[model samples]
Target: RRNDPINDALWDVYIARSTDGGTTFSANVQLNDTSFVTPSNGRLGEYLGLAVDSSNAYVAFTSSISDLPLGDVYFDEIANSDIPEPGSAILIACGVLALLRRRRRK
Candidate 1:
């Protein structure tokens, strides 16, 4: 990223996925479509936060745009075909079967 005078050096948010138990990682994809300017007053933070649901990964970070004087928080989510846990899959199957049986009784 190139340095900037008005805003801090231009920054971008990226994300990567690992499927083979951290053996290999997917290509880094920039999450933020727009610009992500760093805070000028002080350090933004030590690390970024990431949360993974059953189907998607969510990331949060600090970013300051060109218009605002202060920095603001930003977040993004990316979807992936995550494998469902065995217990969860069984629960879903049971729920579907119960619904079907109730409909048949009607």
Candidate 2:
């Protein structure tokens, strides 16, 4: 979530992980790579959207960066060990496609 005032202030993005069925949460982990500063009349809305798959968690939000004049949408993905590397992912995709084609031919 982003906390910003009507005027300029330091905006931040954070993520919390839950391991015990939402009974408790870990400390917030800052996700933004660089500092986000609120621009004039900058409003980042209320809450962000989070999606967690089998091996990765995706966070989507909007932010007004320091250099950018306008706000931009950002997507960050945190992958676990189950996430395949680039090469492995590509190979898996190709294998799936090949299997689909063979099944269609039969």
Candidate 3:
């Protein structure tokens, strides 16, 4: 989830694992090598796909990176062991509750 009021094009792909049944998540780990700007139609991009097996996760997504002006699909592989354990707590907005934003100071 992004809350930046500036630089709307600073789109980056990330993955955060939830260990407690989605009640909390590990800090997001960036999956993309470069930042990009997706289409401005309130969508991150097209063909954002995920395939998971017993030991790893695979991701395929699109990006229009700064260096690569032409958009391209990128693939990433993450080993299940590489995902960090959730040490702290942060709720990722999901489902019908996403529209209800809240504030919490650290």
TM-score of each prediction: 0.59, 0.56, 0.66
Query: Candidate 1: minimum summed lDDT over ten consecutive residues — where?
Result: 91-100
Clashing pairs in 1: none
Better of 2 and 3 by lDDT: 3
Indicate the worst ten consecutive residues by lDDT in candidate 2: 93-102
RMSD of 2: 12.9
The true-versus-predicted C-alpha distance at residue 103 of model 1, in Å, is 38
lDDT of 1 by residue, 68-88 (tens): 677677776656543221101
In the range 2-106, model 2's lDDT, one tens digit per residue, is: 344454366666655544344544555566776565446654543355566556667676667645677777887866343322201111110011110111135
Summarize candidate 3's per-residue lDDT along 5-81 as a digit string, tens digits: 47544666776666565676677677766666664454653447665555676777766764565567778788866
RMSD of each: 14.1, 12.9, 8.9
Sequence-dependent TM-score of model 3: 0.66
lDDT of each: 0.48, 0.48, 0.56
Predicted structure 2: lDDT: 0.48
Q: How many residue pairs clash in each candidate?
A: 0, 0, 0
